[model samples]
Target: MRNKIFQKLKQGYSHLGLGDDILQAHAEGLVATGLVTDENIDNVVNTQKSFLESLQKANDARATSAATRAKEAARKEFEDAAKAAADEKARKEKEEREHKEKEKEMPDWYKTEKAASDKTIRELLDSIKTMKEGYDTMKDENDRFKVEKAVTERKNLIISKAKELGIPQYRIDEGFAIADDADEAKIGEYLTKVANNTKAQVLPGNRDMFPLADKQPSVENIKSIVDKLCPK
Candidate 1:
């Protein structure tokens, strides 16, 4: 079958310059047997093959360009996201640093309270040293010596109690100066009054550095404080 078709195709080509009837017979034979028939069959096949190859090359180039564009776009997006994250981190760090700076700037109430506490601690230390010195020197039996010793001991007891109870030095000093003749129990009671009055004046949400109840000091409490101070 294939040989017949080839023979017809060759006959068609061979009769290209022959008489029209003979060429037509070969052409008709080729067409009937399903062989080559188009006048420009070779040129058209070559042209079509070249055209398809060019089309495939063009499509491949386009695909490569699209991939390059996608890669560039993804890189730019990642860079933008990274930059935004860094900026956000810097913003939060700045906020935290500013907040810490604000905290370092102490408020007026804190400053005042700190100063008072410092003064209280200082005065208490000094009074303790002076009282210990006086106590070491009280050896004479004279009335003057006895009175001086009694006064020093009493003041020492008051100072020690105030220091132990976290009472401010100012209140202790003021109470002693005005009511030095008061008994130890009465002195404690008076100090308690001063502490309560001071607490009443304190602003809401502010804690008192030296807090004391309004209740009067009991004899037992006074005795305990005295024993601790003078120690048998």
Candidate 2:
């Protein structure tokens, strides 16, 4: 539309031999002949200016709307991509968890019994090592009864050591055994872990207060302690 209007204006201008004076004289001639008036020329100029302003405003609004629409489309595409990525991650994690659960649920003779025995072996090993170390450290006393006191003292020392190692739960009393049907290897590994956890250092003379056996002294013999304190 602008191109067409500009072409028309050029045509009119060229007809006047590109001379501003000729254009002005021609316009005045029309007014003198009563064909046009000054008020009519002024009104036409003002109307043309207002129409051009409105056209420019409409063009600006159209450009802004196109830009906004493009941004919205791009944002939606990115959002879809992110959602798909999250869904894939969640699915993989769920599949892995389900596979692990299936593995755990499948039980067998070797798995169950061996695991239990292993547990028993671990506890026994740690307890025996602790008992032996504590027994060797005690000073000799004249009375045979003092042997009993010394053994009990040793067990208490081991308990304290276990507690210090951050494994108070793993600390074995005089008598603790895995279930009869426990897996030997698993039980052994557990006992080893317990022993490792219980292998802790302590300050001197505090062993007496934290006795391994409370109701009965851990002295003289483990069999006696087990029978009296923890028959199981």
Candidate 3:
């Protein structure tokens, strides 16, 4: 229908020397002579308005499609960024574990130094233990309060020395808890045994400083502490 209107306009304006100007002198001459009616000019105006409306609708559709495409692209980019961040975190954790494993493979010099340090610590502990034993033997002779005070001081000294030898504070505390009823000599031996290993070092051969004769788990020992669980 729109095409038909354009054809009509062309035929009517042909006599005006191809000029579609609304007020062409030739067109005006035709209109005054009644060759072309006012209806023909009105038709031309209505045709242009219809064409402009069609073009605007096409432009609006294109803009909507472009907005949709832009939104989808942004969503895809966000997903990719999230995946990349998770992968980077996993890579860092793996690298840290590998680094720690390498560190655990100590050099020969470090082992020798550690062994000598252990020997020195053990000797100091043995001397301290001997002194404590002498104090214990005089338990009846010495004032009770004086003996308890001396034992507390010796225990503190042992804890400080153990920390200096690189034992973790928690392990020292655990040792004290496990050896609360043990004599000062036994406490020295237990700490000395643990002094060679890294922080939070568990006793390799035995978990208990005072194992029961029945070989049963008491309220103090939890199996999970000594055993590593398989992942589900």
Candidate 4:
């Protein structure tokens, strides 16, 4: 029975990575001290194996707990990273949306200015069309008189424009007679060409520059001559 207990203890200690030689030496010392006997040898072996098993169970539980903690930490890190990426994407999208919205909006001043410009153009076009229609529908003597009056008004406007451009009255009348069938735009073009041609012939200074020998120069005329000689 003692041999059987020793063999069982050796097997249990060996399975727990304790060498047989060490176990044998320990058992011998216990026996020499009279600590182990045939009556208690089996109980001693059982107690030692139970202690070793408990130690192994404790080590395994510690390993499992460490693995669980590491996994939780990794999962939390991944979730945080994913949340940060999502937040960045949302922020960029919001900025882009606001930028597009800003681009789509026009200023009140620009809108008002454009509306006014469009209205003015429409009114001008309508006025021109109405004038053309009235001219085309002439029938009676009164309608002919209205047509003549309109023609006279247009001629007067052309004469005024030509005078503004420094064109002589006789030249303006001659040009009108030559382009009597032409529209106002054509007449304007002719006047512009004439004005450009006559620019080189225009002399500098006023009539005071060529005063008659009999006429004495006034103070204003003398000041004008001094201004030309030594301009401010």
- Top-scoring candidate (lDDT): 4
At residue 109, what lDDT does model 2 achieve?
75
Cα deviation at 91, candidate 1, in Å, is 0.5
lDDT of 3 by residue, 111-214 (tens): 78988999999999999999999988787566777879987887787787676565666666776543456765676676666765432333333445435446
Collision pairs in model 3: none
Per-candidate TM-scores read: 0.30, 0.30, 0.28, 0.33
Indicate which candidate wins on TM-score.
4
**Model 3 lowest lDDT segment of ten:** 223-232
In model 2, the Cα lDDT at residue 174 comes to 39
How does candidate 3 score on lDDT?
0.61
What would the per-residue lDDT of candidate 2 be over residues 45-156, giving only the tens digit for each residue?
3334444455446767888999999999999999999999999999999999998887687778757887799999999999999998777665333356687887666556
| Predicted structure 2: lDDT | 0.55
Alpha-carbon lDDT of model 4: 0.70
Better-scoring candidate (lDDT), 1 or 4: 4
Model 4 lDDT tens row, 136-196:
7764667889989988888787888788777765566675543557777787887788766
| Ordered list by lDDT, greatest first | 4, 1, 3, 2
lDDT of 1 at 145: 82
Question: What lDDT score is found at residue 58 in candidate 2?
Answer: 75
